[model samples]
Target: MIKAADLPQTLAVFPLPGALLLPRSRLPLHIFEPRYLQMIEDALKSGTRLIGMIQPNPMRGKKDALHHIGCAGKITQFSETEDGRFLITLSGASRFRIVEEITGFSPYRKCNVIWDGFDRDLGPEEVDKGFNRHSLMLLLERYFSARGLSTDWDTLKDADDELLINSLSMLLDFKPEDKQALLEAPSLTTRRETLVTLIEFALRGGNSEEMMQ
Candidate 1:
């Protein structure tokens, strides 16, 4: 396990919207774009293998404006396909806050990141007190029914609280801003509540755009 002290001060960031990677979670990505391919090569050669996964602000123009907070993931699985694309899985290590953007040698964006604020991510998952697991499960059933989604109930039943929350938070088709809100939630309790509220609103026939507003 990588400690907070081992994390780098600067990180190469991938500005992708609606992609959420939480600490201890794994996100698989396909690197095909020339710039990102170069970024992957550089990371492998440099042996950092760290990439900050952040959401881009749609309100901003073509510029690479990103959310302040993001999770830094280390490349745990890497393979090159026959067609020149890189298939890799990143294991989330820690969350970071962007102190500032810096000019970098690589075409991909780089930012000076601070990990002190999110050092908790390096530790074990903290269960939120007073979390109503039953209610959440019930709501998830309704949400899935309404969305016509199916799942393996047996497998889902065996998942721990943190995995359940983070997996749903990432895999659910929530708006990008809502996903960002989930990522920015100060604690697991708040994140759980926020997710429940969003599901309730959806059940009430509220659209994501209105809920966000």
Candidate 2:
């Protein structure tokens, strides 16, 4: 595992299937299951309250599955209701690669992780503006209109690069492999290209029914 100079000692991790998180976004999670309830308690007690969210691949073997990339989320805000359930809000942190799952842990799973430098600046580069962003915005408008969903366009338009990419990645009806590809994308540019292509395909309106297929 690649360790950063300022790496924290421990992290809270949640192993789930089909969930992805990204930086600068809020992941609101409901913690009611026994194992996850314990995870929350351990995180709060440890004072870090950070959760590494990763998903398993199609393979059933825990040791043999899971993509290499995932986002780390900090437990920014949480509340335990009278019913003993946890309502927690997660603020996205840096991305991490799970070197391997650590053994000898009870209740919650633990893994040795290496930071993938997602927070580091790749230097200022020109964003794709020609046909990509423009076409995406138009199709996005139509897609939302067709679904009868209301959104604050002003807010979405003003979102920063990371927010825009991650938000769209999370909400879009992309296939699992496509979603994993976005997660594994080395740079925002690559991720954006994948998204633009997907949106363009969606805009064509022929294969829209196969969103998950």
Candidate 3:
């Protein structure tokens, strides 16, 4: 429900590594950390209710701890638990580029963001011209079997192109760097290709997530 123009120049970001949220998708978060809990409360009071989900790339050093590209998500729903923790869902709005880190304000990290070149994110759902559901499903089945993971095949079969690709991209157990690669993919087709490539790599005796830097 957030327009591209409505996206603020500055945004509070959740720098959690290995968490990914793409446009039109939803990310569920359990916030217990004092800073993040405060962040949730502050976002509730703000007009946009938007929060950027970024990955902390330690390999990049503190000056570039957070990956430059991240997605801004709107806090669509939230509930406070008895333990003072918050269970919330963020609906992905649009991807952004961090212009600079805004320090010295709140406990959580804030950054100036640039929303240019992401207009296509707000439009209708993208159609993957090269999406072959059957192939993907076969690949997923083998991948799941190898990992001892289970999924609802009926549901996945029913999912559309964008949902199928984006959901898998968000939910897969890829390394933070691989997930970042998925996030930075220019289009849905590219994302799907990247995902397929990752899966293929994993199935072919590639290094495991634990082995990656």
Number of the top lDDT candidate: 3
lDDT at position 173, candidate 1: 86
Consecutive 10-residue window with the lowest summed lDDT within model 1: 58-67
Cα lDDT of all candidates, in order? 0.86, 0.69, 0.92
User: Model 2: what TM-score?
Assistant: 0.79
Give every collision pair in model 3.
none
Give per-residue lDDT, candidate 1, residue 172: 87
lDDT of candidate 2 over 157-179, digit per residue (tens)? 88766677778887777666667
Question: Residue by residue across 26-144, what tens digits does model 1's lDDT show?
Answer: 89999999999988888787656889999998666657688889998898999999999999999888889999999857789999989877877889986888777778888889999
Cα deviation of 89, candidate 2, in Å: 1.4
Q: Please rank every candidate by lDDT, starting with the best.
A: 3, 1, 2
Each prediction's TM-score against the native?
0.93, 0.79, 0.95
Q: Tens digits of per-residue lDDT for model 3 on 1-213?
A: 788779899999998889999999999999999999999999999999999999988877666588999999999999999989999999999999999998796999999999998998888899999899999999999999999999999999999999999999999998898999999999999999989989988888685464344
Off by over 4 Å in 2: 1-10, 59-64, 116-133, 203-213
| Candidate 2 lDDT (Cα, 0 to 1) | 0.69
**Candidate 2: residue 96 lDDT (0-100):** 79
Model 3, C-alpha of 186: deviation from truth (Å): 0.6
Better of 1 and 2 by TM-score: 1
Report the number of backbone clashes for model 2. 0
